[model samples]
Target: MIVIKTMEEIMKMKQAGEILAACHKEIAKMIKPGISTMEIDKFAEKFMLDHGATPEQKGYHGYPFATCASVNDVICHGFPSKEMILKDGDIVTVDMVVNLNGWLADSAWSYGVGQVAPQTQKLLDVTKESMYKGIEKAVIGNRIGDISNAIQVYAEAEGFSVVRDFIGHGIGSEMHEEPQVPHYGPAGRGTRLKEGMVLTIEPMLNIGKYHAKVDPDGWTARTVDGSLSAQYEHTLAITADGPFLITKQT
Candidate 1:
């Protein structure tokens, strides 16, 4: 069933979202050449704990890590490993979530390590904008497809393909809720959105084909064509006024 959050619940989630945002901001600042992704994950875990929130992804469904550090061709759910080192000109994405007093907030962002390639930066720019384009359509009374289509149209026009295997989801007390928010579909289809419904709108765009193959670890997803990909996400609530990004700072 679709979970509708009360204003009180929304406020609690907003607090969690702020902590998640702060975690992402610190992670982004720490992204540079020579750092290991595992180090980043450790820092995030401590940061969340220090602020009274728990790192929700650690041990989630047997997954081992606080943050998913996907680098280059890795689309999402890339395991953070001490062996995985960041180098100059590499683009890495850090996806994370924080649970504060039973409320949850999730978000992801791709960062450039050192100076990246020009085309790679374009891919990142387009992917981030595509997420915002989708968010712009997440208003009350609109179908979820409206948000999906907005992302697809802009990404495709920019010469990128939206990853279909992994889509966004509704987030509340539990991490994943009802009404899967896809990133590609027709504008008029899918469930009609309503106020108080909180969901995540994450668009994963690839510089090449959308086909993704999972790694042997069964978590990390990589582009089949070995092309670079970018992703951005925001947990949002459908308000009477419009869509409010819960993960954004006030």
Candidate 2:
């Protein structure tokens, strides 16, 4: 069943989003070369705890990390490891969830470690833009497919492909909820959005085909063609006015 958030609940989620957004800002500043993905995860976990929020991703389904640090060819759910040290030209995506009180907010951002190749930079730019395009359709009276189609149209036009294996989702007290939000689909199909409905419109774009392969660890997903992948995500709500971004950064 799709849960419609009350204004009171939405307000509580906004508070959680503030901490998540701030954590992302701090992580952005520390995304230089020489830092390990595990280091980034540790910092994120500490920041959430210090802010009186919990790193919801840690211990979730036996997942043992505060963040999913997907680097370069890794699409999503990349394990943060001390051995995987970042270097110049590397792009990493840090995905996490923050729970404040009882509310939950989730977001993911991709960042370049240092100087990146022109093609890689374009992939990042297009992926981020595609997310915003999807967000534009997150309004009352719209269907989930509207948001998905917007993202797919833009990314495919830019010579990129949207990952089909994983997609965005509704988020609230639970990490995953009703109305699964895909990043590629027919524009007028799927669940019809309603006011107070909150969803995450995350578009994962790849430089090659949309196919993905999971590692033996069963968590890390990488591009089948070994091409770079980038993603940007935001938890948003369908409001009477329009879409309100819960995890929007200043």
Candidate 3:
């Protein structure tokens, strides 16, 4: 069943969202060349803990990282490792979730390490723009597919493919909830969004085909054609007014 958050619950989730945004800010400052993904992960965990929140991704379904540091062709769920170091021209996506007082907020951002190729920068720009396109449809009365189609249309028009294997989801007390939000669809289909509903509209756009392959570690997902992938996400709340980005400090 889809869960509609109470006013008080939404407030709590917003607090968690603030902490998550702060965590991402700190991680962004540390994303330059030479730093290991594990180093980023460690600092992220500490940042959340020190802020009186918990890293929701740690120990989630046996996953063992505070942040998913996906690099280059790796789509999502890239386990942060000491062996994985940032370098010039590399793009990394840092996905994180924070739990504060039992409420959860999730968000992700893709960063370019040092000086990235012009093409790679374009991929990042389109991916982030697609996310906002989806967000624009997250208002009450709009179907989930509206948001999905918005993302798909904008991304594909820019010559990128949307990932089909994974998508966004409802987020509240738990990290993943009901009403899975896909990135490509026919608008006006799927669940009709309503006020009090909270969602994560994350679109993962690949520079090549949408096909992906799982790594031997069974966590990191990479593009089948070895093309760069980028993603951007925001946790939002549907209100009578419109979509409110809980993860962004307004």
Residue 200 lDDT (model 3) = 97
Measured against the true structure, the TM-scores of the candidates, in listed sequence, are 0.99, 0.99, 0.98
| Cα error of candidate 3 at position 221, Å | 0.6
Candidate 2 structure quality by residue, lDDT tens digits, 1-250: 9999998899899999999999999999999999999999999999999999999999998999999999999999999999999999999999999999989999999999899999999999999999999999998898999999999999999999999999999989999999899999899999999999999989999999899999999899999999999999999999998999999999
Count backbone clashes in candidate 1: 0
- Scored by CA lDDT, what does every candidate get? 0.94, 0.95, 0.93
Tens-digit per-residue lDDT, 1-250, candidate 3: 9999988899999999999898888888898999999999999999999999999999998999999999999999999999999999999999999999899999999999999999899999999999999999998889999999999999999999999999999999999998999999899999999999999999999989999999998899999999999999999999988998999844
Question: In lDDT terms, how accurate is model 1?
Answer: 0.94
Best by lDDT: 2
Q: Which TM-score value belongs to model 1?
A: 0.99
Task: In candidate 3, list every pair of residues with a backbone clash.
Answer: none
Enumerate clash totals for all models, in the order shown: 0, 0, 0
**What does the lDDT read for residue 238 in candidate 1?**
94
Give the higher-lDDT candidate: 1 or 2.
2
Give the runs in model 1 whose Cα sits over 4 Å from its true position.
Answer: none
